[model samples]
Target: MNNRYSNKDVDVFAWFREASEKGNAYAQFNLALMYKRGKGVRRNDAAAFVWMRLSALQGIAFAQNHLGAMYYNGAGTKPDDAEAVFWFRMAARQGDASAQQNLGLMYRKGRGVPRNDETALTWFCRAAEQGVASAQALLGEAYAQGLGTKRNFQLALAWFRKAALQGDASAQLNLGLMYRRGHGVPQSDTQAVAWYRQAAAQGTAAAQRHLGVAYAEGRGVRVDLERAYSWLRRAAEQGDVDAQFNMGVMLSNGYGTHKDEALAFDWYQRAASSGHMLAQYNLGGMYAHGRGVRRDPAEALAWYRKAADQGAANAQFNVGVIYANGHGVPKDEACAVAWYRHAAEQGDASAQNNLGVMYANGQGVLHDDAEAVRWYRRAAEQGHPLAQYNLGGMYAGGRGVERDSVLSYMWISLAADAGDETACNNRKLIERKLTREEIGSAELMTRRWRDAHRTRTV
Candidate 1:
């Protein structure tokens, strides 16, 4: 019924059969490709493998490379890394850039070859010099990271730039980072954004995430929160864990859109499920506050602990709170003190103040006035109002060191200035007992301290 065969309906099988009878390697390879891709032929891996082997044996470099790939990927035969390596090396020695790159990857990953970065670098250099984009990118990374090469930022930038100009998405992203960090290039947010835009347009998920952050912070362009949200959403949809966490933040804070606590929780959960530490911390807070889900203190503690184990200071502080408050757990002051100490050492102001209170009250740790003063001083210097009040009390009572009424008034005044109502009331009582000259000295001390260390809000 379909006898009107056009030029496209040539007898490919007969033509290939006649060429095969003549021992034509090119025709054999073409026939293999036809079978492999089911183009004008039935897709038969066994037939493809047979023809590919015949073509490869005739020393066709492309055929050799394809045969190696087929062996490596088990596309037309049983997977055989050793065979893949052998064929790759054969094709690489024949000056096939792609085969050289594949051989380098195999050596680097120790698949059917001893892991040798130097050998991998050598092969990658060969392929890169031939203008293979992926190999150029790999060579750039090797130089940048000193993997089988001297650390050379200039060379890294050069290779990355070459590959990026050739439309290599990964190289484009790395080039942007190098520009942003001023590595072998003048730090230029504008240049960074240009390269990031290129890679993001190419659908590189990491590049999209970086571009979103740049837009949000006005790094290279004017701050456009809506643009940031759009870019971040694109990356998040592609399963970029960090982008997912950022989406949660933007959604929760209503940045560039209406607030959606429920959606924020969902995004946070997605990232947290991927083992993102900050996402785990945010999820803990969501569970604690019942923002999108029902309040569950135990669930909050579980998430907090997961993040804490990864050295999240905020999560560590929350863990201390959970232990101290006995929220869905037995109240263990000692456990609370341990967790508080962990966070305090990491420069968490609230944790330092809480640790100071524990020492002052002999709650979990041994009662030591000096320890209390030390912790309180640490937090107070960071402009923590509660720490300022507690430190002032310690100074006034002479509990840790000699009584210093001037320092006590200075600290209390600072706490009051920061809007601590109790500090204001205490300052009023303390000022009545001071002479005019003493009050002047205290005020001068406060002014000097404030000038030296500007108070920063938590």
Candidate 2:
């Protein structure tokens, strides 16, 4: 009986092999699958490749698609993108949805052809119309971003919904983002959170990070710091830069756990090393203040410069202060002025005030009283007390504007109200110079200015 069963099994294998040898494309394709999967045959990828190629050459669309995938993935042969594209094109022309999607990816990435967003979009549309979930998602992203056509948020939302309903994790994550940002749909944090939960369960790192932030801020959910930390840590461990930065913040502030500056520093270092601008800035602060690490001015300057190069205004200001004070290097007033100007142009009040001082003292550039007044006025209008005091002094000295005792007294009085001790003394001294009528006008001007400018927190 064992011998008879063994013979029957041999005959079953022979039946397909016989037909495959006779140039039957279907039989050849079936034989290849059997060889590849070791179903009723010993596994042999090389043999599978041979049979698959034969079937593909005979115009079998399914076999052509499988052959393309094999070449693309280097299965049973060296990877050859050109060959993969050729086979994918063959099957795609025959209306094979899988092959169409594969061809679109190749065009999109320039894997086997010149990158062409328009062509990729065309192929993706064909595959998506045929109900390919991944193709639908890709089409949605292209529409959302205006890759090959005008941006159409409604179309993107529709495609994302189709893919997300099919359980595509990436589609779910993007749908969540759209809902959260109110793009193409009414803003609904609850709906966003619901979709994020689904994608997070599937291990989508970006979705996990968003969900954690939602929990931390009590958006769409009650405040749950513990849950927030847990989700953030998961995404952080997956190498998500934003999540890593958030982890550092949570640890430093002891928001969901015990304060651990050491761990915070570690997280900040990881994100900074990955080129995160905010992480670099925070790392510099930790080094500058000796928080969770040894105080190292040089290290602080290095990190600050990295962030400054990435256009962080605060980092530029910090870099200026370091250069001016000779903290980590020789004092370079010229360099300090350059860095200060960078921050000042970005509307940094402290930087504007410092730049005004530099112009007044001719420390880094030629002394220009008008330029000093220009910067001082800008800062003063933003409620900088020191700038107000400096502007008052300039008026008193007739160094920037026409000397006006009433204007000087008014500015000095405004600075005094903000608790500038020097300005208070100067105001009293200036009062002696002003006539009683001038003093009354100055007092009235001070009251008007005070009412116009609400106190601004630094």
TM-score of each: 0.90, 0.85
Candidate number of the best TM-score? 1
Clashing pairs in 2: none
Error of 2 at 174 (Å): 1.5
**Residue pairs with clashing backbones, model 1:** none
Residues 1-458, model 2: lDDT tens digits? 23433565556667889999999999999899878886667778999999999999999998999999999999888999999999999999999999999999999999989999999999999999999999999999999999888999999999999999999989999999899989999999999999999999999999999999999999889999999999999999999999999999999999888889999999999999999999999999999999989999999999999999999999999999999999989999999999999999998888999999999999888999999999998888888889999999999999878998898898888889889999999999999887999999999988888777767534
Task: Give the alpha-carbon lDDT of every model.
Answer: 0.93, 0.93
Off by over 4 Å in 1: 1-28, 41-58, 74-83, 455-457
Residue ranges of candidate 2 with Cα displaced over 4 Å: 1-81, 413-421, 428-458
